[model samples]
Target: MTLTRPETAATPPETDAAPPPRPEYPRPDRDRSERWVNLNGRWDFEADGHEGPITVPFAWESEASGVHRTWLERGVYRRTVTAPADWAGSRVVLSFGAVHHRAVVRVDGALVGEHVGGYESFEFDVTEALTPGVSAELEVSVTAPADKRAIPHGKQRSIPRDDYDGVSFTPTSGIWQTVWLEARGRTYARSVALRGDSLTGIDIAVDLAGDAPEGAEVTATVLGTGETAALTADGSGHATGRIELAEPLLWSPERPHLYRVEVRTGDDRVVAATGLRHFETRGEELHLNGERIYLRGVLDQGYWPDTGLTAPDAASLLRELELARGLGYNLVRKHLKFEEPLWLHEADRTGMLVWAEPAAPSRFSPEAAAAFEAQLPAMVERDGNHPSIVIWGLYNEEWGLDWDIPGSAARAEAAVHAYERLRELDDTRPIVENSGWSHVRTDLVDWHYYEPKLAVWKDFVARLAAGERDDFPVRLAPDFVVDKSLYGSAEVPRSGIPIVNSEYGEGFTSLERAWHLRWETQELRRHDRYAGYVYTEFADVEHEAAGLLDTWRRPKDWGGARPADVNADTVLVLDLVPLAAGADIEPPTGPLALDVHVSHHGRDSVSGAVHAAWLPAGTPVGVPVPKPEVSSGPVTAEPFRLSSAATITVPPPSGPARLLLWLADESGRVLARSFLDAAEVEPPNRRGARPGEFEDAPAPGHAWQPIAFDDS
Candidate 1:
């Protein structure tokens, strides 16, 4: 395969100015690494047209790839690996953690394996094919289409200009992940099904391809909670039994409880975890553990700058889950992508609910559908045991399906018929028809719209959630508000990172991005979205300076990144149970006419303290509109800027008020105003959470009653 990598001819002396990359991610990862060999460090690489030294795995266009800007639509990778010394007599199985789209694998030039899916694990049994003690050279050829339907590619923006702003995304292919060899015993278990049934107890099932051992005793045990069971199985490698738990804990955004499972035979042991709960949609309500559960979810496109699709390490992956949990979000809609098994494991162990999505193909024909069917199960079978995954976002924004599919008057009926198939495939999880679309059969109506983008339409949110279903979270930040107002578009930290943050806060800004928008007329053309300066950013990545943090996960280049503050939309809630940090506000006793004061940061908008009441989620607490006022001073409180800095200060209320103040910006954008001193800041969800266990919940010196769980 003559790969056209022109960059390889420029290698200098071995001791160049560039520092060598840190090869090790972390050694403690005993879960995903045990069954495979580490094929990560270095492999002999050559390009199509140029035969020279190149880094394996990383694409030639990447800095790690050691290649220049020369590009190729197709490429090949070759590496030689010898059988492990310990596996002198074992079966050597070659495994590719991931190979984009189309890859052909040959061992010693003998065509041994071919896999079509870009985002799945593929393996070939080379034990019988390769000679003993012989070094086997494996060659893999990869081809990527301009816009392939079968492959699941994420946000890979191509370069549009020759002059490098360094914001361009490089293309990828070949063995992107670890390509290693493993040894397998006869009749090894391929996959295990672990279920924590609330009613029938725990159901354990194992599936194997090879001949099962006669009288093989299958033992299943739950780690933390004392639950164990054993059953003798026949030669089919089939076994079904139940383990008993004393008291089962329900899994929720507030309390995600996972119990470890140990499955074993004479010599094999596989360990994983599952929770006892159910997630289904009944009528208008999404039911979990046989009760209604509201999912405060954010959309997360799992992408990083330096690493591309792969995270820096598991720490980076956990950061995604932890940041969402910190923001009080209960669910994360894993948008348009299927993450690696380790990601799902983190969600399961950490207790964040995952809405797994398959990459939406731009085009889907009968052949494409067949390809999807073949690959979808592999992803599900590997991830199904996870309790954290509650919903499967099979199709997104008409990726495979189309606009006309949902545009027909029979939209709900067509959707309902299509939904039956997903339900049949995975009975345990819910299916979202399309994110940000309304379907009568949808368990949840996924919607998306930028604040200013939808501000003109007015019915954007209503139309998106406008469905016949009686139950569903009608309005939630409108997929999230893309704040684009040049004056005061804002994306504040809604706790931490949202599971999704499907929408931006307000407007956006960067140095030259302004001119680009001005030329293309994207935000400029529409005279909206303030030219892609959406209100808030997670942290500024590359040239996109809207993020709360920077591209490196360090605080941004400048210091405006606030990773500590928690933000509320309509009301800011604080748990001031006496000793909590910033819990010094004294409660008022008399019938005080609390005035409302609003303000902006730089301009100093509001002046005096205003009196306001406290209102919980379902409670009825009202305060008259402060009409319009603008004042300023050294006083902490200020008058609200409906357009930009919308901060409101409230004094103690008259009655037994639990509600804080309600605020509306000039444009009626509601900002959160919470009155409860927070009880606990961050409660570990590993153990099913107890109500008052948060660090902030029982602060020093204050007598307090626990607030109803606000996690979800």
Candidate 2:
């Protein structure tokens, strides 16, 4: 094929200052070599009669790419590289970490290959077209259409919509990850699946790419354990084996122990890590390595302001993982986006569990069906080896499924087919057919509840357990789940799957978030049938200001409560805030009388000193309050006991002030703390009545009518 170019010649990028060094090779499973070359520098780009140098691997819609325009049209990339003389006998492989939508490649005026799917990796063997020790021209034509329904587009949009769109960020196109080239033998290990067996050891499955000689065998060696297994390849070029270890150190959030395994086939070898662990659901609870555990998780969207879908650097990924771990979160629900392998590798090393999902197209059609069906299985196969990923989320909130159409068994069938395909691909982890609603043939009954009132939330869960469902209006489609599940169809009974509040808490104040989280978390803990919970998000995105941290990753203080005070364990609770974090006290000015509630969630008795004080907001670091009082005298306490109506009288101060309460142990270490702002803050969700306003629970069969399409 002849090389085609636009009439205008491309110019230098907008800025001459050096961009940060390109991120290191992002594919964790692929083997590394000194013979590889990084093609991530400036590349000539052209689109819509405009031409300029654009940064490779950074999408055109981002500032880091030196071109922040999203025209939703075709763009071209061109570069030149000289082939290495030492790579004469090996195959010259050109690999793309990921290219958005579709791409056509040409090398030295000859068409080499074409790849579709924006979120997957692809490679081409270009050795036959390369001249030894000579430079070869390379070009790539990419197309990312504005029609969001046809492709697997995550939370991005050509035109902003309501709620998650304008509040969310912009969409990205073109190359959004690293691009590189390397030389490999004719026959290589294409992929490997590693599963841990507690009693035996590790199970190894290998898939090969090129031709292998007769009698060729694949071997797996455990690095530190000195265990090895070898198996001969069958006619299909696949092999399986098992390695036994003398002692096993199972992986958990508390202690993340990973065992490295090296797989060799023919002249090729690849190294990766895995921990001996399995995640499954039993009766009403989720178990990790055969022990029941609650998932204290935060939602991560994996988007950045400057780089679009890419992180600024390797350390940027590490910082987010470290921050989540420091805040006592053991798992992160990677919302919507299928993250790069580098991020998943870090999660494995840091011992963080992940709930991975495929990015959904905006609308449903035959094209959407084909696109999703093709990509979902590939996503599972590509990410199956990572030990951190425990759950495969098939769909989310019915984005692409046409549930509104009457008697649309096709929509339901498509969802079930995807779930079955995933199970066939990897049977190690549980599958969530649909995340929020319209769950069909799923292993878990996951839903969302965002009512601001704690008492209402308690009632909702109780109603669900009693076979009476309540309205989940937030983020639900008008015609959602009408006849999709057993709740509507008589053919299927209430699947009785384990329940989890997958998403909640989008807009709440510091104090409200603290109190609401405490109540909701304790409620789940009190009920064994509910598996666990995942809060809406970890940090704020664009206009959504409901994160524990702002967009720039700065922590928004939780009234005065620290991380340990709100974590799952500790077992201490207090409620002294006169109103929600940003609400005004009714009196507006005077000596205020505050009645707080306190309770211990532990099972053993304890003794501690309760300290209370009222101080101005801007008091000096070490300066003490003018006059402090003891709310509760030091005394022995019994387990599961409640102390209600504890009052603390505070004289009105000259300026804005706060009341601080702390319960300290014998060593003077604070076990629990709560703070109340004297003045009204900003943007509180104190919408209607507070908790307990509707004092009585609904009668046995009187399930709150679920909001439906026919109703408001």
Candidate 3:
């Protein structure tokens, strides 16, 4: 074992109380107790017929749940509680942390348990419905129905589905999340799991609960690292062990570390949190602990104009993972929502990298494939001990497979049996089977083009990154025929694995969605056979305004462009091809050559120089632009081009302008930038504006305004 730094817990002085509405711990990796009890705040609600108090975790149609009303269906809730008077028989339980599609519960009214997915987590025991210290009556009863075909309900919707009409939203119904009461004891420790392993260590299992006696023991430890392991409990309650650790430290997205274990047995214990790494796929890229890596990812859609899927607190889920790692995103596909294990424990304390999925069911039944295969083993047994989940996804663009996975051979064998039942429940990440297209089996060959032109999305992403197109015409449902080799039974071979485009972006204007997110992230880092590209969102939810923030999370005015300057991992790829209606270089009747390169996924090799600035055609996309008007002088960095090719030139910009192009490094520091625009033709003040409007004026009634690009 070799773990360090895991102590920090001191701040607790100020007190006028009143700050516990979602006050964290909705299960921070199984946290087992200080005898829990949050149960959020104020309850006794009702629905559809309307009634009093409601905020116990938002979702009464949001607006922080003061009952924002829209379409309720069924609700209830009640309250009462009590059980804290010191020593009582134990077990109490209760839990919840998620309840959207259906619940039930009831303590002093009888019926004890019920759960039906909406996104995992559920508990009950309720210690024989309370008594030892009096007071009971809990109740619950939710519903959330407007008919979502057997229920998984991701993008919510109540009645819209002319193929996800305007990409559905609103309808989180009933208690959205958080509601506690824990306690434990009678025999405890029902589930622990762990895993780790950066070359041999941490494996533990546990699972006991209520009568676990035969050999009992269990153990685990590791916390500050005295390293412990031991196991035993087997006459059915199960146990298992491991711990090794020689060197350990490896979790990445650039150092995320984490260890803190704990476990115990008999009287129970809990506390988890892991990390060692090893995300796979070497043949076509994406490695992780073994290194390679490159998945900028974004698509979050967790939603919250005032807490719809709960989370307007707990530091806004670590400020939306520090604003998607300050916009350079190192993964976060959480799209079809299962989110909130406190946002995967803040993406395992901010090293961020998660793909996760759950919530599909729209139509296609056997009770919607058993409510979407009962939420994939309760979301891999409640987030299979997060190492910031490296991807599990399962069915997206095919919704409930009604979108027809290539004319339905039983919906492509139910998407390859939900990717072999989540690779037999946790084969440690990588699943994606049916993410953005018709891929029958998958370990990532991802796709989801949006194609808002840019010369036909860079010639369909350079012919699907040179393996010469592996399907893409996308219709979604009219007769459905996407054909992954005619419905995919298993054959994603584009040189075997790692393709990913996950979802591209379109525009409506934030400078044309920051110029199609800087030319589709510089044509997916000018293709080194891709391996990543998630864009299409990260905010703007009630009616998808194609966010880069905006739905109160703010940041949106890339007309000064700065999504970490084209999501840096070292970038610059400029062959300047513009025309999805903007012109990146045309008025050039003189010097204007171009041809630069340098994708560089960094691990070394990066000399850097390539400058070039111009800025004028309304300069504003992230401001700051002055110096250089040409330089390529010392460029080196090769991973996906740039073994030669620098060219650069400049001059001809008498009217419409804005060129920029950086690279720097070798102490000058820039490391990637690109913005073109020029022009002599189509600039009647840069047309198309609408969503939040603003090429020159109009920000008050439609409200978004941050214009500039005007050569008029």
Candidate 4:
């Protein structure tokens, strides 16, 4: 079935809601109290000496900022503030959560520090520039080059590529995150890393900066669990220890239990939340806390209509998580961009699993590689403590790397280097070197195939399941092949790595969209070798209409079964295949012959019967579609149980028609349902026959062909 021009409901009006208050200590990993000041409201932005007001943290291109412009050259932010009387004895540290491309900070007309990377946080010590009871003038000059290749900007196009369309977004420039002033003692926690292991419990490491007093010791306490560990700092001021919990409350999608931690040394204390769980792949299946897991995930591009890349507030991020959970997705693939700490903190709090990726660099070069690698350690270190981030996506579709070269030695070598480098930074999580359509050395075998043909897709998956290779266009790269031998070699080589379809199916009508989702998910459920799958996206962005929700975050109903129902953790799937392709009926149409494919995932066995019925167009049948008189015989121990439904009839409709099939339990509770659009054929007039009525040449034959999706 093909649906064109899918109808969409009206979206809510855009609001000029006031920006919410930001937390003083934006970084949860290393938080501080009275010493921090939020400088996020409005700043004096001078562009070419013309002064104007621009929101500090919000991107200038975003509507949230009064100055709704794209790229600004030679912009200087000037501000002045007096130090609080209480902070007389402490040193002042100026922090910029993030600035685009490059930024240079000056205090009292003297250069203090400069930062090149746009995605990572940077700080400058302004103690010497500040005088007691005096006002300090702060100025930051930012430059964002129009050349996209100069920086590692993900999904943002300076000059649009031929393939770049509405699927992506516009570029963001200068200070998209929070900027603030922090006052601290001479000695403080510079950074911290936390990891949870089932065997060893939880490990915490603290890196102290400044002249730490002698005999200082770092003490960590697990808030509610009464678990504590203390380690004395060495001369260099670094401390490490491990805390063992009494009873492990393993974190999962169902119950996201977190252990709050407090670490203190000297006058400074750092607080963080972590979950005790392990995510690993055993053979072809993913195990969470030693139990096999089927990841039901959605592709989330962290963009807001009004705020651009930055979410307006913490509540908005929470709402997004709530929506995903309500929709039956246990995981979210943070496509390309690394999201804000607030969102990541919310994910940890709400128990949403995330696959975090670095922002993709536009092109390949030695300079680009250096810039990209320079930012990975800081990114991983800051985000490593969050348990929601289970996997790290080092590259995406070979964005900034030369993976298309023949033999692809450079790409393969780069992939291995990145994988190994990230492993050294944080060995707690697996790494996807290049998320889709390529594999040199990766923890998972992932591919992006938008195969729309159902039968062809099914045959390809079947061949993979049978441990046979097929020439079905499985390439090492999206545009070319790197290693034909390594493609689908996981199953053949019997590699313990798991497999995921990272992306698939974009832009379909409501009915077609719903049907396609069910079919693709069922295919994965039937194939136990596959670990899990992530749909193309959660919401539509710009011209990409394939999202389950519109750009405004409004939900859509595609067909009989809600998208959530089809994606639930434990549910039955009924695949109906008609025996005969063409059936001609006039006034009295009889039961149609169909081959039923019954399967269940997230459960050992399914005790259900199949029901076949017909409903007219626009009819709202109860879900899991209403059960009919034709009951399924029995379910088998096999993954997909096939049976035949013979001679179930349906009455003709006034307009267009539909045929519905439902899987119901023994108690007549509907588990799942599927339907097909029906169009009555006008019987050939024997009295005056048309020229090609019986030729069967004009109309193409209809067959059940499955669709494919991608993981990222």
Candidate 5:
């Protein structure tokens, strides 16, 4: 596509000095020294006849970009830079971490190259476009159409309406990732793929670039350990070898150990970090390094209030991972967006497992399918080296499939094709064909279910775990039936596959939301057939309020309850089903019996005592609430084994109350806690009173007599 220079071309700033030190290197997996420059400070920006200065890495719609506005059809950025004086003969390359939709690069008005995918990194050899130590004008033109059906725009609303827009959020336009320049040797490593296996060691593959000759010597040295592996390049410029460790330190969420390696060939050297670990499914269970693991995951949208998709700073990326880990989550499902490499790097460093997927197109078409498929190879190639990523997800909730995969054969085929395409790209990780539902093919049988009624949710969880039902009710289109199963027919049986509640949670209030979090997590843990679960979200985004934290990343008031309490590795699962939120019923007149079970995922069996207590409903909100009143003597915990651990008789309270239950080890350390709210109910005769009649006095026919009740 040819383009004429706009009259509002952004002019260069009046400065000859070098830019400030850039944020941490954009690509942590492949690091090169002193030979690169970060172009992230400022650039003259123009779009839709308006000209101004915009930040380099932030999207135009974000507050951090200084050009915070609505969506734009097109945007142009211009800057001038001079190659470092020290680099005399090496080839200079202009690299863009990523650009939205489509981007065209130019040096001094001469077109250098172009890239279409927005999430993949690309570069151009700019040596021919400039001379050493000379100033060169760099220009990038970007076009981001608002039609999401034609492109992969995950959760980015195209035309926001006044009503609910589901999970859609603000749209991001123009350059949203880092831009930089690097110098490479005549024969440098183009790409490096490292596959570290605890059983087989680390497999290394290097693809050479530029004028690479045959028989080039390639060496990979594991830093600190002094272990090295060597390989020779063939006529095709590809070298492959394996590095075996004498005693491998396997990587796990409990003990995350990483191995830093530096690979060299001639003058080209890149440093990468990987851990020796293996993730697989062994008959209805997820195994990490040969040990079964229960995935405690939270859905992370990778967005910020002010920065949009681009994190405000490097520290923000690490902070989010740390926050999730602190909440007792070992895995984060990076929903939709192909998150920045820096975020993935943090996951690797902090020992958090990641389920990564690319953005999905809103509609199904040949062009849309191709656009979606185009991102898979690059996604796997760019992120396959990270051992933290255990699963590759595609097309969440049947998006881009017209939201009708069960009835349409063509859409089903498309979903299957996408699954096969991703598997072909990288077979090392488990691939979820359609993450939420309509699983034509997948390594795990996962579903997304949301129900606020405690009784219904409880029954469904029990039936699904006991293998009584394989599908949940889901409605894709207006006329479609809601009873259809997302699972494929006889072709794909659900037996022997790990079942997971990938997405499930619903509540409008913070207290209600926390109630759901505690109950839902408890239900999942109570079933041994279930492998894992991912809460709806980590933090609240624009319109979605079902998050553990608010938009500002502050923990919501969970009414004296902490998420870590229910998210612990060992949890006490109670059989008492509480009433739904805001629903009141007559309080029990006799002793309340509850069956308690321990769900422990630790390395060894745990022996703990089940404790029960009651707290006045009017207790101060922020005070510590759990104080045990009755303890069931030490009992050996067994998975899914229910026993009547507690029975307490108390006088019905005059007002609402809370029943608190907890599991404590021999040392008295509280491992998990759960609470049941007993809402206040009116007297038998007062139930017939009009809503307003009881405000100031008793019903018209009843006397205003006070009944005595225990407060404790």
Candidate 6:
């Protein structure tokens, strides 16, 4: 069922309707702790012959840079930087994190380098191209067709916020990433690839810049144990060998193991670490190594309000990955765009699983498919070595592309063909023919069930097992719904394949982008009949606000139950804006202080009444306001007033005192929850660590532990 591949779309035009190319920061300083070339700030800027302010790393359209909202059709940028005299005999490397579509680099009127691909790093060796010591003029010319549908671009919608002007879909141009100079010796290590296999403990490959030195002793030093393993290679600058590891420290969401690796060849040595593990799919579940590995993953578009497709820097990558890990997510499903290689590298180091997908082929013509096939091998070959990548998604929801299918038996035939093609190209991983389960063509049957309805999902499962839902998970023409509880717009009357929730949650953000429509409002048009609810999203992309957290990374108002969009993209209360000197405060007269108190609220279920428990830490021997009346129950009065005493204060304690409260209904039921709010009676007189502990708050993170409400 393999359909002939399509032709590549014609190269983008030379029209004067785009911005000039820019540099991207795909690589960073090996040390990574200090000293950085802030490639993201203040570059000479312009657009379509219009004078613009210098905005280095940020896109022309983002608010972070005070640049105008006006985006560019095409333009050039010029910046001046003098090379360090010590770099006399070094090769000058111009690196770019990403520039939307195409780019060309110019230095002192000499064409230095050019790059393609909006989601990969491209660099050029410019040792003999630039001046030394004196400030050399660096000019970058960029041309990008902002909103051409013909291109394989995705989700770059131009929905206006306060005003207009900026990148139409986020502008592109010079140095979108970090650009710096790297001094290479006669023989230097270019990059390293660490792969851990089930049979083999781990395999290490090194990409070198110059010729491999003869009789070079390549030694790999494992951190922690200080165990050094040595190996030899023929000549292509690659050294491969497996270590004698008894039980490899596997990387999982619950346990992330990072190993430091040092490769020494000749006199040059490179040090780095990688997380080791294996990802595969069994009969009904995805496996990490040999165990069932549930992917509490977030759908990350990887778009930044300020940086567009490119993250601000590698540190930004660390922040997102670590935050996701803290929230209990083991996987990050990169939707649409293929990330820069460094992002994959970061995933390798940070113990996060990755499901990489190329931007869908927009125009579903034979030519487009062929072009996609041509480009796909490169994408897989270059990024495939990463162990974090578990699956390859062939197509997403929007594209209506199909393959070898005809007549009544055409259901998943086309998808099966597409899935097999990807498998043929690379058999190491599973291929999801259609991401949203639009076509159940591959090993994993993917379904997106937003706003879950348990009955609908169960019935759908029944149908797949028995063939046809019959009267179970019902179907409707314009849409369908078996259970009124589910949320969806398209309903499939019959179902097949192993259920995988592709899209479930929606209406993510408090910010603008895409607004959330309630399940009832959409009339349960086409919801899922699946096994799980993957939920719409975990964080807000630039315009797509339906996220577990707002753009600021703060959790949304979910009645404080938590785990409502809990994994990944969650905001920590510790990282919140405090009410007092903490929030947008003017300089203080003295030390910052706050009245700290804790109060618990709930029902005394057995008593059918309210009860309160509170502990205070900062209450001095008060002269007045003694015996603060306190009550714990549903706020009986307006403004959610607790039936407690005058004021609740913490008792003397070294740590934050417990303020537990209980509320009950007339029938002894919990009656839901009651009102209880704590306030700062007075600020701590002195600064630094407080004497007592605090009333425990929910742990800030993205992990999901299903809450159990015992009716037992």
TM-score of each: 0.64, 0.81, 0.39, 0.84, 0.89, 0.61
**Local distance difference test, each candidate:** 0.47, 0.66, 0.74, 0.66, 0.75, 0.47
Clashes of each: 83, 0, 9, 15, 0, 90
The top-ranked prediction according to lDDT is: 5
**Local accuracy of candidate 5 as per-residue lDDT tens digits, 628-705:** 677776766654333334443344545567767777778877766766667754344776777856432311100011
Q: Which stretches of model 2 miss by more than 4 angstroms? A: 1-20, 159-168, 197-199, 213-215, 403-407, 453-455, 465-470, 475-496, 508-528, 561-564, 571-578, 582-712
| lDDT preference between candidates 2 and 5, better one | 5
Q: What's model 5's lDDT at 711?
A: 21
Which structure among the candidates has the greatest TM-score?
Answer: 5
Lowest summed lDDT window (length 10), candidate 5:
698-707
CA RMSD of all predictions: 16.1, 7.7, 22.1, 7.0, 8.6, 16.1
- For residues 1-712, what per-residue lDDT tens digits would candidate 4 score against the true structure? 0111223221112234744234435766455754677777667787764578777677777766666776565578878866676777776788887888799998889999999887888788677787547887888898887677746887766663412222457777877888887777667667777788563478888777766644577889888767899887777777888988777787766677777788777676667777777998788778778777777888888776656777665556557888887777888898877787777887887888898987867667767767777789878877888888888888776667754422456655666678788888987787887776557668887766554545555666666666675223433322332332225223233456788776655325644555566666766666667777888778766555667776667777765546676676544443442211122122234455555555444535555655666666546645545546465565433332322322333444454555666666677766665555555555546667687454322111011111232322
Q: TM-score of the candidate numbered 2?
A: 0.81
Worst 10 residues of 2 by lDDT: 1-10
Worst lDDT 10-window in candidate 1: 698-707
Off by over 4 Å in 1: 1-36, 53-57, 68-71, 130-134, 149-151, 157-170, 197-200, 211-217, 224-226, 231-238, 290-292, 407-418, 438-441, 453-506, 510-548, 554-712
Q: What's the true lDDT of residue 349 in model 4?
A: 77
454-554 per-residue lDDT for model 2 (tens digits):
55666666666566763354423322223233221233246355677777662246555654555555455444456667876677665565566655566
TM-score of 3: 0.39
